[model samples]
Target: MLLSLFTVLLWGQQKETQEQLERRKQQILIEIKSVQQLLQNERTKERNILAEIEEQNRKINLSRQLIKNVQQQITITNASIKKNQKEADELQAELYKLKEDYAATILKTYKSRSNQSRIMFILSSDNFLQAYKRIQYLKQYADFRKEQGQEVKAKSEELSKALVRLEEQRESQKKLLAEQQQNEKNLQKDLDQQKGLMAIVQKDQKKYNDQIKKKQDETKAIDRKIQQLIREAIEEANRKAREAAAKAGKETTKSVGSGKNATFELTPEGKIVANSFKANMGKLPWPVEKGYISLPYGDQPHPVQTHLTIHNSGVEITTEGGSKARSVFQGEVLQVQVMPGGNKAVLIQHGDYITVYQNLSEVYVKKGDAVALKQSIGTIAANSTGKTVLKFLLSHNTDINNPQLWLSRSN
Candidate 1:
């Protein structure tokens, strides 16, 4: 009984692990498709070496990621193959033992009954009760022999199935290995292309450096403006909460957090939204339905020049052209400001949290409008340079949090 329970538990764990791996594999495949689309989109327009390098960089990153995922799947298949092989061996051993027991039972039964018919055996008894007992013994002996034969047949069938399963797992492993190899080749090609581009870029180092500096300055300005907007939104939210509490004859508590960063004191309705939003951390949908993260949040060294660093207030997502940006959660639109580059940005107030979606070409939701989750706010701008990138920011009062941490895993 203990062995049976252990087997059941072990099987359950294995099944769960396989399910998780399968989910991961599916997500990676979706990411691969999304990246492929972006690459194709980039290729359609006029060619620029910088753009080409960026495209190759993204492609290589995705290819390496794909290879890693395939490697994980291969590991799982290998484990399954080993497990099946062990099961097959055990079943084979069981079949052998069962067959031997069955043969011995048959031989003993034949020896006992070789010279006696049922009627004769019964007649040999001393009295009526004794004859009846003898008849029952004969019936039971025959039943035991039949059961032994059935056991042998069942064990043999189980062994055959186990062997078949082992073979299937091996085949799956082989396919995964081939896939990994192909991804590796693609990754190497992209790497080589990136290296050639880097050489060209280094030759015109001053020109590229000036461009990088200009872009960095632009990013800092945008981030500063966004943070300013977020602060104002937070103050507005706090003022309303205080007014509401005063009307209800309740005291408004001070905001939480330390230093310059503080979360606003929420009203009853606002508190509900805040709680719900907090609960959905790392589970909220992306602003775009499908995309890949091109520029991640925070300060990092530039891809080409390690000496130069880049600062990003939020994550930059690359998506297909003509795609619309959607609100990740239900919120009241605070402001829809037009930035310096003619790019539009939408700020949505979700309790004490503020979400900003920038780089929009057109605005659909105006200030003071209540938007539902996943509602289209505006269309993302497709740049003349053949890039469609959306800048997404998440802030709690004055403090900026990485949007990637709040958003769901990309697939």
Candidate 2:
């Protein structure tokens, strides 16, 4: 009864541990889901959620797998215990027989225990060879009995250990199974949150598209402006390079970077602006925090009317309810224009690179003011029907580039 009560107590403790592990797993799942929601957030503040979600998912899977292993172990352990019990019972019967046989031998020896009786028993062997054989047999029988006793003792020890091992396995199964259950619940919750976000996005698609289109127009305007500047800059660079080649032909072999002539054209302020942008390439941040790139640089389908195609000078990152447009790199603000339907756009110029932030509801920087990387140019506007978005662009003179290639991926 004491042993039964102890086993029950052990199981209860195991169950409690399992419950605690389950709760912990659930907590991680909840965290992962929360991160997923952040990725869907329109404001997209620090979208570090994706990595968190992925990492949590890996752990959840591992936990589930471990639970499965524990369950299998429980089954195997139970089977082994039953087999051990049966073998132990057989060993006990054999042990009893060995004891009885040993007792009978001793009893007979004692009953006939006289020196004359022993000699007569030996003489009954009838030949010297038979007597020698009887002595050898007696020694062998004693050794066999000792070995049987050792076998029974070893079997009992093995059975005891096996039972303990089975209990441990059973406890593990309970604990891990509880953890898996908790993880599953957490996963369900996350799924529900994501579903809610997706529904919201779908419901606001029309408003989002209108906002995106207005921003796209603003981006195009900036592209044209940047292109004109690039052409002038390129022409100036070319003319200076020619002059430098004529004046410093012998020294052309002295420099390895871009032609020195291209360096002399920019005024002090312009040089500073250009240099600042050049130093931060591959380091610029994204314009908005949340959203997957739906339409990248080059040609793309109209988000509102898929059958009607349009060329995109930049990428469109579609995100949830609210987001702001920010500078991707440091530069002088060239212009901020308010478009029809309440959206605004900002353009910033670096030496050779130009960045544009569109779909804003308001402007923060005026033309000629320096804007730093990730500085909010303005809150993005809600398009017709009221949904928020940011359209972002990167370009060199007239050439449009995929923003995915320019902005630091770490952002």
Candidate 3:
């Protein structure tokens, strides 16, 4: 009984794990499909080789992940199949023993089948007390026979169910194996496509390198401008705080620090908002409803040009065209930065922390506008390559942080 309970608990855990894997696989597939659509859109327009390659690289990575997920599922299925087979065998053995015992009991009862024989056996007792004891023995024997029959029936049914379950598990394993094979084929196709793209990229290394460098320079300029804006916002907030303290005739020196240090002197309300934002780290929602991180934060090697290093102050999330950017938390809009390309960026202040949503074609909220969590701030602009990417940045005062670290994993 203990072994059965343990097996049940083990199966429950494994089943839950399998379910989680399946859900993850589905999510990956959905993302792959979304990326595929973006690639198709890119194809419809003038070809931007670098952009195409990047999208292709993203798809290839997703394909590899999908294949890995399928492989894990197959592994789990195989284990379940093996476990079920062992269980079926054990049930069969137990059922066989039950039948054997039940047959013996039936045979013994058959030998004294007549009611008269049972009565005579009880009458043959020498005294009244002996006869009573003999009758009680007969009654117990009958009850034992009945219970043995029921036990045999129950064991038979249990064995049948086990066998059925074993067969089902075997079938499931077969289906999983087939699914794995198909995923491998799809992955191979993606890899082949990636190789071809890499070959094309290698043929004109200098041109692509120059293009990458130019883009990197533009990004660096934007990042610098963003940092300057954040510093200015911090200074402005601190300036206001100092003035308020001075007007109230309070000690401004202790209440508000110098803005040169790149920190905000928080008011009681500001402190609450800042504390709340800090407390919800890693629990913040994505700025876009449907998107994935195309580029991560900090310095990293370029996707195609591994020799070249790329620095990103924030994560670039690629989403469907025309998708609106939203605020991850409640905050007041600090600035609306308009870039040279006519695109805009909205900077929101949650106390000392600032969240920047860049690459927006249109802004919904202006400076000093109070915004709620998940409020639509602007529509993300699609680049020449037809890819709508949002450059999302997070900072505490003037200190940069990885937005990916703050955003919820479910995104």
Tens-digit lDDT track of model 2 for 305-380: 4454677767665445656677776677665665545566676777655677767777878876887767777877
lDDT: which candidate is best? 3
TM-scores of the candidates are: 0.90, 0.40, 0.93
lDDT of 3 by residue, 1-411 (tens): 999899999999999999999899988988899889988888888888888888888898898898889888878888888888888788889888988988988898898899999899988899999999999998998899899888888888888888888888778878878887888898788788878888998999899998898888888888888888888888877778788878987543233344435788777778899999999999999999998888899898998888888889999999998899999999999999897577998999998899999999999999889999999999999965579999999998787998988999766
The CA-based lDDT of model 1 is what?
0.82
Per-residue lDDT tens digits of candidate 1, residues 1-411? 998698678767876887787787777667668767766666776656666676677677777777877887787777777777878888888888888888888787777765557778899899999999998998898898888888888888888888887888888788888888888888888788789889999899999887778777887898888877777767776777799898989866578763367567777778788789989999999999878888889888776676977888899888888889999999999889998789999999887788999999999999989999999999999754578889999987777899999999852
Cα lDDT, model 3, residue 101: 87
Better of 1 and 2 by TM-score: 1
Give residue 328's error in model 2 in angstroms.
1.6
- Tell me the alpha-carbon RMSD of every candidate: 2.7, 14.6, 2.3
Global lDDT of each candidate: 0.82, 0.59, 0.87
